[model samples]
Target chain A: MSARDAVLGAVKAALGRSRPADPADPAAVAAEALALLADPDAVRPALPGTDAAVAFAARVVSPKVGATLDRVEALADLPGAVRRYLDGQGLPHLLALQPDPALQGLDWAGFELRDAALPDEAAAFGLARWGIAETGSLVFHSGPDTAVLGHFLPLHHIAAVRASTILPHLEDYAAVCGAAPRNANLITGASGTTDIEGSYVRGAHGPRFLHVLLVAD
Target chain B: MGTVFKRDVARALSDATLKTAIDRTTVTAERKRAAALTDYPQFAAARERGTRIKDHVVAHLDHYLLEFERNATASGATVHWAADSEEACRIVLGICRGAGARRVTRSKSMLGEEIGLPHALEAAGIERVETDLAEHIVQLAGETPSHIIWPALHKTREQVSALFKASHRDPHKTEDVEAMVESARRELRDRFLSAEVGISGANFLVADSGAVCTVTNEGNAELTTTPPRVHIVTAGIEKLVPSLAHAFVLLRLLVRSATGADLTQYTTFHCGPKRPGDLDGPQEFHIVLVDNGRSRMLADAGLREMLRCIRCGACMNHCVVYRQIGGHAYGATYPGPMGAVLTPALQGAEKARDLPHACTLNGRCQEVCPVGIPLPALLRGWRDRSWKDGLVPQSVRSGLWLWRFAAERPRLYHLGTAAAVRAMRLFRRGGWIGRMPLAGAWTRYRDFPAPAGRTFMEQLRDRERGR
Candidate 1:
């Protein structure tokens, strides 16, 4: 018999093999997928459509991290507002940054530096080239060679995004890039999950807290 | 004689504790998969799209792969191609040696497992720790993964708690899932910080950028590949796609089809090494493109489409038989309908001789395959080849021969059925047979309805004659 006949025979035999199939409703499946993606508590909810999907991904995958830094002096002397903001949130262990060139000498801890990997335990709040201003997310790439540990392994993941970097809508990103990236990452706030149960735990796979620095600068 | 393959096969088939672990985990995973698929939309769309994109990528693979390599090299990542698993392992191990890596953290990748990475790395004196929650459980248990998606799906909460207590010394101080995760995390975090190298698997290799994609519900995949100065990726050649746009399409389909998730918690992309102004990332990047048996598969027109599979477990979850026997019974790293077809083709018929016969040919796997693989047809091909090559047992051969003979002639078929019916009636009563010698197992679990005795033809004849 021809391949067509063989396929038909197989289908017939398969139909005989199982009980009646539950109907397949495609629209319901798509709606459900959109709902999951939009759900904040979802563990990487499926982004709806090709546009939302790509934008959400670009935020997580192609973050505009590693450009430049405006260091503000002593850890304590740094912006009181920034420190107090964090302190009110119950976060400590922040360090001081000085752009004196002598102290900010090495490429390792430089502000807005590109092509550097995140140190294994280091916390970084770098800027993403593109972001969802509404959600205050930083877009960047996470791979073995990119901000490897800084993306997820860090105790604190703070991403600084320029307000100008923010897209009015997620759809505008694809037009901005022209074509989709091979792999894009969109990170909104911090990485959190409740996979242990429905108990809503933070930081199962990513940073426990996501602090977004929406810098007007 | 003492190869890892032999040992793995033996361990997979006979290890009672591991078998139990795989069985329970696979069932739960299959259930979750069902729940996930049932609850999600775009599932069918994702499956269709996944099938189309993978097919497109594989169709123009040579162009896309070259393009990827060019872009990847441009971005400062070195790409290596391995003809087989050994070569891939050697390339990765050499990278470790060159980097002076004493310890390594691993994210779960079946490709790495397929190549027997841990064993090879250990031989090179590199300490490797599996950091994925499920992988950590399996590693601590010293077992291989049963389900591709949920590697530790076999373990129950109570079992994990017990394992946690026995495995860790400071268990009393922390007694919850968070604590258990924290302990594993804290321990692995130290390894990530100290290790000079990170090893991982790629979900999709973009041909346009020469980038490797790793999708995870957990962050360990990112941590394992990053942080270390030297990063190595061991991936199957079939994973390559044309571009990042295509990558998204596949990713969209993968999670939705595999676990019914819109997206995994972490979907990260790595282009190459750290750029000039980068703060953290590997100093170097190496990708090992493993052919193993895939190139051979591509040549076989019938089996070529199998390469398009994205390793989603949708088919396995929908399979009635797979749900019952679980993955261990399939006796390979890949289990279920996909495993039945892939193992024999990749490993050879003699090595995986039992796989083809193990299936009931239900074809449910084909219905749900994201890549539209004709699984049953391929399985049937394996069966025919096995028999033609004299791989079939003598008893099975004789039985088939008898069946073929009876099936060829309607008269002989009737004679056979009449005789069988008479024999069944002598032992059957109350529309049920309590037991039959060779068929005892069937009756043990279920009541066998008695045969109608009179052939349909005989009844037709009687009615016409008005006897």
Candidate 2:
């Protein structure tokens, strides 16, 4: 009678299922989905044996991702690393920081810090929820403190991740993120495009440079 | 569609620029894919897992689609079902109208092209801007995408620069790739910020979490889904996978096969709109599950494997014929070996009668297919069906019949072959035949090599007899 019914009917007839599943019983469907979600380890590939932090550092610095990695011995050392990276790249003094507790209480004297990402911000920094070693991806969950636009809208993106938060594989990252956040971005490297004659050009629509500061305690 | 295939192929072959463009791009893509796979040792295992997951999902598509609907609805998003392109367009337009959307920013979606969404929206007085760089070029040029992943692979830098200069207000544009990309970035940024609705195609629809995952290197998909108030993901029913883990398996294979990257720059999972504490994201999330002709594809057991396509474009990249003729010659939304079988299966065997015959039966497509779809067998099956349906041209049918008659008996076959070789010797000049009867098409391109005086059978028999 409805589009849904017609689609389901056609699918059922094609699949050779004589009768369709009961549409009224959504609980059963949800239960089945929950079962699938509960076991996220199935069909996972065997990852490399490198420790999460080491793998994360190695993968990010690889030519494929082309992301610069900075290691900090403690959270207190983050500002120094960020300052050194900014000075090394000869970037501007101003940077937009995500409104997160981890990024707060940092001694940023010379830099003009803003809470929101401006359209033309030279660099924007955010705290990653987790680091995926397999793909050198930073897992950022969308929340009040972590703005989604700051990750892409800026010319340069700087992310800080705790060494302990790094995981070996995407499956592990998925389990950590739970069912779903509003947005879960696994940003691996600087934004790029091969759209023009298949030439690899970085910073097509997103940040040109991605520098990750891996804070270890 | 029938006449356009040959004409398009002819034009593509003659265009040296197009040939160079395709040859360079496809060679680079193939090399990258090979190198990426070598770096990832688990590619074979992951591909197997991906195949198993897709097979399971397609087998139980009805169940998974329902599960996805329930979960997505529970996550504060609306799910709409469209049995055909008309319904899909109607639902999308209705949603846009309901939300009072005028300017829509769309990420590159093959499904959007399949359903003619842009034309539909334009007809309803909505301005649709394509955000992908290649897609933007094709959009400005008023052309359908030639390749799925790299839509403007057929366009040279000069052509793209010309298109930008003609379309954009920038008078100082150069033919440099980065400058053109920057120009597009600057122009589309305003559209992304100001669009009322964002439309995208999902790489995978996670059934458990009701998340629509889109993979992109340009981050357009992320921007397309982020800023707009209404984010609509239009995906075919076959885009569904059981869970996030399954999605990762396919994701690994997809990037490696498509662009030879270890992983795309951005693989974002949008669960629903924005969550309770989210600062910025779309407030409304909707998914339109489009069937179009997939139900018919599923109805036939032999054709059901077409639904397993991840649209990685590997088949076309590796296809010799596709490399020679390019994608426009296929005269369909999809092209190449996959398109040859899929186009006929989706849009009747009769309509695309010439498509299945365009293949050289190289089996390269199937060899490189990540899903291991026996594409050559499928194309051959389509050819058989076309012949049975009387779609083959009369000349071809009569030629095949003549060959069949001669081949039925070995004695007659040898006799006919000997006679043909004798006749070829008479017409031979410079070790080649300038013209042949009923094969003007073959002779028009290059001289056919004259057959040896004796057939292979006769030579083999004499050699065995120690002559």
Best by DockQ: 2
- Every candidate's DockQ is 0.12, 0.59
Question: Each model's TM-score, in the order given?
Answer: 0.75, 0.95
True contacts kept of each: 0.17, 0.74
Instruction: Look at candidate 2 and tell me the lDDT of residue B326.
Output: 90
Kindly list the per-residue Cα lDDT of model 2 for residues B413-462, writing each as its tens digit: 99999998898898789899989896586686669999898999999999
Candidate 2 chain A TM is 0.87
Q: In model 2, which runs have C-alpha deviations exceeding 4 angstroms? A: A22-49, B171-174, B425-435, B446-450
Scored against the true structure, residue A56 in model 2 reaches a CA lDDT of 84
A111-186 in candidate 1: lDDT tens per residue? 3332333334334444456664322244664322334445575556655455555663433443375333323566
Error of 1 at B317 (Å): 2.4
Worst 10 residues of 1 chain B by lDDT: B1-10
Query: What tens-digit string does per-residue lDDT give for candidate 1 at B1-467?
Result: 11334344454445555546545544554555566666555556555656766665555444445566778888788888776677778888888989998988888788998888888988888898887777787777787776788766556555666776778645525557677666665556566678888888999887656778887766777777667888888888789875554565566557666755445656767778876655567889988877777766765766778888888877776776565555655666888788888888778887777776667888878886766888888888888888889888798899989999999998999898888888888888798888887787467546788878687888888899998
In candidate 1, how many Å is residue B447 off? 6.0
